[model samples]
Target chain A: MTLVMAGAISHAPGITGREKMAPEDKKTRYYDACYRFRDHLWDQKPDALVLVSAEHFGNFFMDKMPTFCIGLADDYQGPIETEEFLNIPKTTIPGAPELARRIADVAMQEVDLGYSQEWSFDHGFMVPLAFLTPKWDLPIIPLNINCQVPPLAPLQRCHALGKALRKAIDAQPERIALIGCGGISHWPATPDSGKINEEWDRAFLEDFVANKTDRLLRYSNDEIYRDAGPGGQEVRTFITVAGAVEGHGGELWCYEAIPIFAVGCTVVNMDVAA
Target chain B: MSVYYLDKLMYQLNRDPMVQARYKEDREALLEEYRLTDEERQAVLDEDIGKLYSLGNQPQLLMHFAALVGYAWMDYIEAMRVGAEKYGEPQYQR
Candidate 1:
């Protein structure tokens, strides 16, 4: 078996934390899209889900941040925000250390990756997991890109990491699914929170689903900040996914800017099979 | 302002329950442990979400700390807005 499924989705904490605040129809549609994404993932019957996230200082700190990191543990705990804040209970999620180590060993051949034996899931990871694997039954391999801080990894490097990951996962015998979790264009957790640039989001998603590496890598940090806000930097996660599934275009499962969620809530199913 | 130390305090407060408990039980003592300036220390002591935001604190860290200090989602956003108005723009973006 090889890579069976690949995609990306929004992981705004407000999506879950402020669920009741959003309009009913909008929330329902967005959530339904997420549920469908989950079902589509399970249909692939993957042995592990490599959840790529832009961690918000839950485990990584400014003191020592890794540009890209993967968890190498038997189990991990999450929702570091608080059951009250994220509206998701703290719980343990299983990890596939064996598969993760193999992937890491193979991935390092092409890209530099920091690894940890211990990690606690922030909303970046928890928010998506809440919808994608509600039962917490699927084993996960958490991967993080430093989207919170600047002097960040270059977009090209993120794409390279994705290519390496694709190579590594393909070498493994187990079926694996990969999902990048991030906001498209919003100012999260800032005074400007709830502001979304739908135009910018759609443009990015267009390049993303098209697997147009050059276009996706074209965005400068300054331009991104000016148009999409800091949260838009998380596109690295999506870019990596696009790199992993190169030459394959994707279908837009959903895209909607939910203000309370502080992001253009999005879900894209990459054409891995194609 | 030492964004590093400010971030360190916030990182601990966000992830470590023991640190959160210590801050809750005896904040002044805990505040003294971090090499924070008077302004930073005071901001934490006051639970000033807006000032912290203006002081260049990371929004994610501030958001969690706001919750620890009893900020509802909207209140936290509003605090950042009000703080920006009072203290001027934040040194950092996001």
Candidate 2:
């Protein structure tokens, strides 16, 4: 019962970088939702936040990409993009290395989890942190899923990783908050950057909130790419969160299609049995 | 096509500040390091992100390079659109 909170959200760079570029009213509504979500997360007061993220090429690259990599450093520096570009200052965030190592050690028994002594944050982790942990004081345990490259971990594996993490978190004495950040449906960083499929996103969110493993895993990568664009491939993160909170349902705190933000903005809270 | 090398160059240029400084100070010398095709070299030299996009550079890598090269967010989006129109859809994986 150490998993105090588990949920998912969107982490598009535009959520922070291009904040002012979007319409004012829409931006305020979205930010307000983020504020409420943050309040709820902080209320749980977990000892460590396990951020399951899908990074761009900030740390690992095509040279050698890992299927899953958890940070094992004492501290990690981030928003590797220029401060002028990402609009989030590069800062060193303390890491929960001992907790991370223990989780990795246990999770490896079920999955071949990789551990990294060195890692940096891209917009994927930065944007979410900018919203959820504005103070940046909470110790973090970052986990990465290879959502960008092809041959991505299958949806089932993403779920399995979540289940494994649940076992790992339960064994720890610390209260752990698990949050998965990624996509709903959108084309990001391309010509179709501002395009979002609201219908597709809502449908997927329905499946996600219900924790419908079968329905969530029904999407093939090709179908996601075709319907949700390449960015949609990041649904693996959400699928992983569902796996962590298996059998428990979720609440869709917020979901809005903010085109300038690229992906549909989403915030969800999952139930954790006492 | 040396798209893999081209992609590798993008990855390095985005990750390494020294590589970025070199890219800024001595474009030709920096370009010489990677096994880029003439077209790839020209695209980097020309700052033609559209061509790079069409050449199958991953958008994740290409986007940071776009920012590095001083593209505003809208400009980066437009560059990809124009590139797609001029060069057809991106030639991903090849």
Best model number under DockQ: 1
lDDT digits (tens) for residues A1-274 of candidate 2:
7999989888999888888888888788788888988888889888999999999888888788999999999998888887877789989888999889999999988988878888889999999999888889999999999988777898999999999999999999998999999988888898888899999999999989999999999988889988998889889899888999999889998887889899899999898774
Tell me each candidate's TM-score: 0.97, 0.97
Worst 10 residues of 2 chain A by lDDT: A78-87
Candidate 2 residue pairs in clash (backbone atoms < 3 Å): none
Against the true structure, candidate 1 reaches a TM-score of 0.97
Q: Model 1, A141-240: lDDT tens per residue?
A: 9999999887799999999999999999999999999999998888988999989999999999999988898999999988888899999899999999
As for model 1, its CA RMSD to the true structure in angstroms is: 1.3
**What class would a CAPRI assessor give candidate 1's docking?**
medium
